[model samples]
Target: MMNTYSFPLSTLGLPNLMIQTSDGKRPVNISEIVFLESARNYTFAYLTDGSRVITSKTIGIFESPFAKHGFIRINKSIIANLSYITESCKNEGYAIRLLNGQWHTCSRRRTSKVKKVIKQLKTL
Candidate 1:
C-alpha cells in the first residue's frame, strides 16, 4: 500500500506563509504540493492527497515562495514540486510526471531550468 502522509502547519519550517483556500486560511506544507495550474483569474493548487484547492491569487503570486521550497516554475501555466516529480518526460516536448501520475509540460524557455532542478534533487 502507498504510505499515507501528512504534516501539521505548526511544524512546517515556513513562518506565516498560509494558503487561502475556499474554507479559509490553510497552512500548507510547500512540499505537499504536487503542482499548480492557472485557470483564467484563479490558480489551483494540486496536492499529493489528490485534493485540489483554488486560490484567488495568480500563479505568479506563488513564484518567490515556491522557489524557496523546491518548486520549479516549468511554464507560465504550471509550477511543480521537485520532490513530487516521478520522472522527466521528453516524449512530448519537455514534461514531468508527478508521483501521483500527473503530467506537466515545460515551455521552451523553462526546460533547462527544470532539468537543473531535477538534477539538484537527484544530488540531494
Candidate 2:
C-alpha cells in the first residue's frame, strides 16, 4: 500500500499551486509542478491567491512544456499558472485574471508569446 499524508498545500512548501480540493473532485491536492527543459529538473510550488513563490531553480532553466495548456510565461523571471485564471482583457496592456479574481499584468515584451500560447490552448 502507498503511504499518504493529508496536509494543506502550504505545508508541502510548494508555492505555485493555486487549486484545492473542492466541488467534489478527487481529494488529491493539485499543485503547480514545474519541469525545466534545459536542466531537466522538476520543481513544485503552491499559489496563495495571487502571490506565489516557486522552488529554487534558475529562471532560464525551466520551461513550461504545458504552456499551451494554461501555463504562461509572464516574464523572463517567472511563469504564471493559468489554471487559476478566470478572465482576461487586452485593452492597453496585457493582463491575466486568476480564478481568485486577481489580475496580474504581463510585461509588454512577453505579451505576444503569452497570447500565442493561450490561443493554442483554445484550439485544443
Task: Give the alpha-carbon lDDT of every model.
Answer: 0.75, 0.47
User: How well is each residue in 21-96 modelled by candidate 1, as lDDT tens digits?
Assistant: 7799987666667888988789988877999888899999888878887678999998887767776767658877
- What are the per-residue Cα lDDT tens digits for candidate 2 across 1-124? 1111121222253333332232322222234432111222333333443333334444453444444434566755456654454556777787766544446677889888867766654555
In terms of lDDT, the poorest run of 10 residues in model 1 is 1-10
lDDT of 1: 0.75
Q: Residue 49: error of model 2 in Å?
A: 8.3
Runs with alpha carbons beyond 4 Å of true place in candidate 2: 1-44, 48-54, 64-70
| Residue 84 of model 1, lDDT score | 75
